[model samples]
Target: MYKILKKQKWSDTIYSNWIEAPFVAKAAQPGQFIILITNQKGERIPLTIADSNAKEGWVQIVYQVVGASTLELSLMNEGDSLYAFVGPLGIPSEVENFGGKVLIIGGGIGIAPIHPIAKKLKELGNYVVSIIGARTKDLIIMEDKMREASNELHIATDDGTYGQKGFVTNIMDDILKKESEAIKDIWAIGPPIMMKMCTRVANEHNKQIWVSLNSIMVDGTGMCGACRVSVGGKTKFACVDGPEFRGNLVNFDEMMLRQKQYCDQEREALMLLEEKIRRQASNG
Candidate 1:
């Protein structure tokens, strides 16, 4: 059992947890993820390695309460334990000092994964520009952390309650229009629609873009084709092959459809969990 060393509620539906998983922590890299099961009967869920301390034997995972497993996981506290913790799986983000500036774009909870990648790029002596966005100011997280890793940090929100009154793509558009020639590469992690739109903008500017796909994954290995996605007209698995791929080559529409494949079941499961919680609260 991996102990939950610490927990912090980031927003109304999002939380961060530091888990004591020595082996996984030791092997973790910027873009890899872990498959966790709350209990023996729980469903497997994949969460990105937001941050890690190999020597300290812990990995920080930032997750939003979107499904049954995540809701149950969020109810867990610092002293709780997870039934199974398997990872540092998937390919690590390619870290290289690409001649000029690197733009890291993250939307909502996607900011977590970009944290480590931004840090790595900075270490490689690349000029990092991080753009993080959420629906509102209350949803923004890890501001100081991202600032420390990036040379410049920009923030955006759908409702102007925070940094800028727009999406991360809007900021990207502005940057591209001004400094397109100096941008070496762009890395983005977010909802499929957002990433797809970002890809369109980047492609228009002829920028190289990399995106991470958080598709529905079962097993964190290639054997489970649940996370298969089409890239450049070919099939690829997000678990083993990548959670990262060239954004311009990805078929975002198809990916978006696959993501909604179990929405009905997911909604039912979440409703059941919430009802159970309400009943338990009343009984207590």
Candidate 2:
């Protein structure tokens, strides 16, 4: 059983947990994820490792409480134990000194997965510029960490409650217009729609863009075809092939549709669970 050592609420729907998992922490790399099960009957969920410390035997995971499994996870507190926490799974981000400016764009919880990538890029002596966005200022997270990892940081909010009153793509466009020559590559992670727009902007400017795809994953071991995505007109499994791919070549429209395949059922489940919980509380 993995124990939760710390917990922090980043926003109304986002949370971070520091869990005791020495082996996973020691082996984890940027872009790798883990499969966690809350209880014996709980469904496995894959979560990116936001940060880790091998020596301390701890790994941090940032998650959004979107589905029933994640909602249950959000309810877990410090000292709570998990039934299963298996991995440093999937391939790590390819970090190298590309020897030019790198721009990292992350939206909402996507910023969590980008944290380690940004840190590694900085360590490789690359000048990193980070752009993070959320629906509003209150929903923005890890601003201080991103700032420290990046040579320059930009923030955007859909509601204009933060640094720039626009989407992260707007910031990307501004950077492309002003610092086109300095930019070598762009890494983006966020909602499919956001990543799609970023890729479109980058491609229009002839900029190299990489995106992390987070489709609905179950086994997370590549055994399940649930996380399969089309890239460059070919089929690729997100679990084994990549959670990251060339943004311009990915079929974002199809991916977005596949991601919501179970939304109706998921919503129904959540509603039932909430009702049951409320009724139980009243009965008690």
TM-score leader? 1
In the range 191-223, model 1's lDDT, one tens digit per residue, is 788899999999989988999999999998998
- In Å, residue 165's CA in model 1 sits off its true spot by 0.6
Clashes of 2: 0
> What TM-score quantifies how close candidate 1 is to the native fold?
0.98
lDDT of 2 by residue, 1-284 (tens): 59999999988899999999999999999988888999888888888888999999999999999988899899888999999998888889988998989999999999999999999999999999999999999889999999989999999999998899989999999999998989988899988899999999998899879899988888898898999899999999988888888998999999999999999999987898788889999999
Q: lDDT: which candidate is best?
A: 1
- When summed lDDT is taken over every stretch of 10 residues in candidate 1, the lowest stretch is 185-194
Q: What is the C-alpha lDDT of each candidate?
A: 0.94, 0.92
Whole-model lDDT, model 2: 0.92
RMSD of each: 0.8, 1.0
